[model samples]
Structure formats: structure tokens, C-alpha cells
Target: MASSLATLIVSSSFFVSFILVLQLSSFPSCRADVGTAASYSAPYLPSACYGREATEFPSSNLFAAAGDGIWDNGAACGRQYLVRCISAAQPRTCIPDQSIQIKIVDYAPTATTLVLSDKAFGSLANTSAALINIEFQQV
Candidate 1:
């Protein structure tokens, strides 16, 4: 009976590990780029891409303002990126395993690579940080 129980436990463990691998494989994986980001508040109107008439903030409040590197001459207006906080000046500023899908609704002439909305920034990391290292992949 002891040997039988051991066999059952090992089999269950293997089965659970296999299932986790399968589930993880189903998620799309893409190459990520290292960059820096900061948070910005509302008044995102008169954006470089949309002009004064358009103010379509995603209801999710997950949006960002692109920098010159990603402006792409206004071509990156509606691009969606999956952003994750990788590091920060202060420890514990980043939330582990947290990422958010955000739309580029505007552009910023500022130096920050991305100016994420308040909600978006807070969701991934501590908002008190003026800047944080990020890993981003276009999704």
C-alpha cells in the first residue's frame, strides 16, 4: 500500500506539471524591447495623431503617449503594446508578473519612452516612480 501511494503521488505531480506547461504554451510569446516609462494624467487631447477632435481614451484606462522613437510619423497611433515593469530606481517599485496591454492614443515630445496613463502605470508598478525600466512587446 505504501508503494502504491507513492506511485499515485508521483503520477499526480507529473500530470499537474504537464498541464501547467501546456497552459503556458497557449499564451502568445513575443520579443520584448527594453525601455523607460512614466505616468501622465488626463488632458490627453490634441494628440499628435488624432488632433483636437478625437479623444478616444480606452474605457479600460489602459493607454499611453508614445515618444519620438515610437511616433513613427504618426503611424503608431493605434498600436497596442504589452508593457511590464522590469526595474525601477527604488526597490519594490515594480509588481512582479504584472503586465498591461495599452493603446498608443497620443504622443509626447518628452524624453520618457512612454507616458502611460495613471491607471495603467499604477496597475503595473508603484506610481510614485517618475520613471521605471520596462519590457514592451507590440501586441
Candidate 2:
């Protein structure tokens, strides 16, 4: 009986090991390629405000005389500023077509043009050029 039990145990162990090996071998050893790459164009030029020195535009003050522009319509990246503004009182300006009102949320040292959030960019004229004229009124 003891010998018989040992034989059964060994057979079961071998069967289990064989099944595991078969399962592992059935899977392909080679890995599938799942890599991807994305391409981006140069940043849009804020042409309207480019030559002008860097100026600060704050939300608290209703300043329109200052030159502000919006992202151009159908701009690849400027679409972000479709219909949002830094402030509610400020309306979208249409002069110089590609202009938007961009609040100076962050600063850019090497940037020749100003950067605006999608919403703020949408508040000015629509264009993809670097710059556009902006107008504003206090509510």
C-alpha cells in the first residue's frame, strides 16, 4: 500500500508539471510591437503682439486699448480657445481677425509671442497667426 501511494503521488506530480510546461510553451515567446510616435509642428507665431514688447494683461482691469489677438480659426492648436475667456465681462474682439484675449497666467522668456489658454484665445479674432488685436470693456 505504501509503495502504491508513492507511485500515485509521483505520477500526479509529473502530470501537473507536464501540464504547466505545455501551457507555458504554447504561448509565443516573441513579443508584439506596440510602439507609437506623434509629430507636432512649430508653435504658432503670435504675430500681432510679437514685435511689441512683452506686456502684462490682467483680468481685474478692463483694458482694451492694449493690442490683443485671438487664435486663428481652424488653427491646429489654437482651437483650444474656442469660446472661453479669462473673465466673464470681456467679449470676443474681431479686429485683426486672428486675435484673442490671453490672460498672463504664466510667463515665457524665449517666446516671441504670447501664449493663451484655448478659451482666452477664442475670445479674440480667429486666426492661427502669432498675433491679433484685442478689445475689451469693463462690466
Candidate 3:
């Protein structure tokens, strides 16, 4: 009887552990399904150094400044997002499959504008344009 009880406990524990892992693994897929895609004509910031401290960013850094509504103060720092160019001033300005991931490193106020690094903007669309439309979702 003692051996059987131990076996049952081990089995129950294993079942529960499997269920927990399955649930955790589904979180990313669930979030992607529920995430709302937003479009914006974000302006490009020539310099990546943003915020009061003017923290310098690496040349290859793909980052953006979140607008006030979505900006959680500095909480947005290091949050990753997937950005896709939806439209541009010129035809075929955006490269195919050019959707790039960017990290939030600063704030852009309540105004409807996202300030991206020059490299990030240039990769998505014609950098000469004052603004470029893009679809983005938080990852």
C-alpha cells in the first residue's frame, strides 16, 4: 500500500507539471493572437541618444521612442516590438520582408508619433520622407 501511494503521488505531480509547462508555452502564441496591430507615421530621429541622460546607443541598435499613450514612463525601456512598413511616400519604398524588431528606449509624448533610430527608419522606408507609416505590435 505504501509503494502504491508513492507511485500515485509521483504520477499526480508529473501530470501537474506537464500541464503547467504546456500553459506557459502557449503564452506567446496567445499574446500574438490577441495583440492589436497599430499603424503610424513615425518620424526618424537622427541620433539614437534619447531621454534626459542622453544615453548613447550602439550603431546597430534597432530602437524607438514610444508615444505618451503607450509609454509607461521608463518601463518601456528594453521592451521589444515588431515593426512593419505599411506605406511610404514613394512606391515600393519598403523592402520586402523588412519587418524589423525594435526596442523602446525613450518617450515621444502624447502626440501620435514614434521616433525611431535613423537606421531603423532607413531600413523600413525612404529616409528622406518626413514620416513613414508602419504597423507595429509589442512582442
Candidate 4:
């Protein structure tokens, strides 16, 4: 009876671990990096990358202005990133299970990480908050 109990326990442990892995795999990220983001209001024209062109903004208005870290001497333009709000000064500000794919539209020296469009920022967090720590991965 003892041996059977041990065997069952081991099997259950393995099953639980397998389920956990499967659940993690189902998450949106394959690999992600941590950072911070701030919101930016309109007049998104004359972008450093696209130069006042309508193409600078995505149809969904989900876009970001790359900061120093990813500027890559202007190569960051048009790059897309998957960004999610992980935390903030007020953790409750973050929307649950929310993430957005944002395109890089310009360069921003003032942002801690990147400057997200109002719509993009609102998707991951409440508009009332100015900033949020984030998990991001270039896609």
C-alpha cells in the first residue's frame, strides 16, 4: 500500500507539472523583456521615422516612440513589440490579462522606456495612471 501511494503521488506531481508547462506555453509570450512605458497624447505627426506621413501610425493606433535603449540609430522605426502592463505605482491600475502589439513610430528621448500612444497605453492600464512597468518582446 505504501509503494502504491508513493507511485500515485509521483504520478500526480508529474501530471501537475505537465499541466503547468502547457498553460505557460499557451501564454502570448515566447520570450519577453521588462521595461516601463508612459502615455503620449495626439499630434503624432511628423514622426522621426515616418516624417509626417499617415503610415507612421497603425490603424489600431497602437504604437510607441522608441527611447534610447532601442533607438538603434534610427533602425527601431517600424519595429513591432508586444507590450503588457505588469505593474505600476498603483498596481490596481493595470488591466487584467491585457497586452498589445505596438509599432515603433518615432524616437523619444524623454521616455524611460518607450512612449505609447494613448490608446495603446489605455489597453494595458487605466488612463488615469501616467506610467506602468511593462513586459515587452519584439515580435
TM-score top scorer:
4
Model 2 RMSD vs true structure: 19.2
TM-score of model 2 (CA atoms): 0.24
Residue-level lDDT of model 4, residues 1-139, one tens digit each, is 9999999999999999999999988885567889889989889988999998985588999999999888998999999999999999985999989989999999999647889999999999999998899999999
TM-score of 3: 0.56
List the candidate 2 regions with Cα displacement exceeding 4 Å: 33-139
Candidate models: Cα lDDT each: 0.89, 0.34, 0.65, 0.91
- State the local distance difference test value for candidate 1: 0.89
TM-score of each: 0.75, 0.24, 0.56, 0.77
The window of 10 residues in a row where model 2 has the poorest summed lDDT is 33-42
Better of 1 and 4 by lDDT: 4
Query: Local error of candidate 2 at 94, Å?
Result: 46
List where candidate 1 sits over 4 angstroms from the true fold.
Answer: 1-29, 53-55
Itemize residue pairs with steric clashes in candidate 4: 46-52
User: Cα RMSDs of all predictions?
Assistant: 7.2, 19.2, 6.6, 6.0
Minimal lDDT window, size 10, model 4 = 24-33
The worst-scoring run of ten residues by lDDT in candidate 3 lies at 31-40
Residue 13 lDDT (model 1): 100
lDDT, residue 4, candidate 2: 100
Which candidate number has the best lDDT?
4
Residue 82, candidate 1: C-alpha displacement in angstroms: 0.3
Q: How do the residues 6-115 of candidate 2 rate in per-residue lDDT, one tens digit apiece?
A: 99999999999999999889985643221111111223234233323333424332112111222222232212121122222224323333333323323233222334
Backbone Cα, N, C clashes tallied per candidate: 0, 25, 1, 1
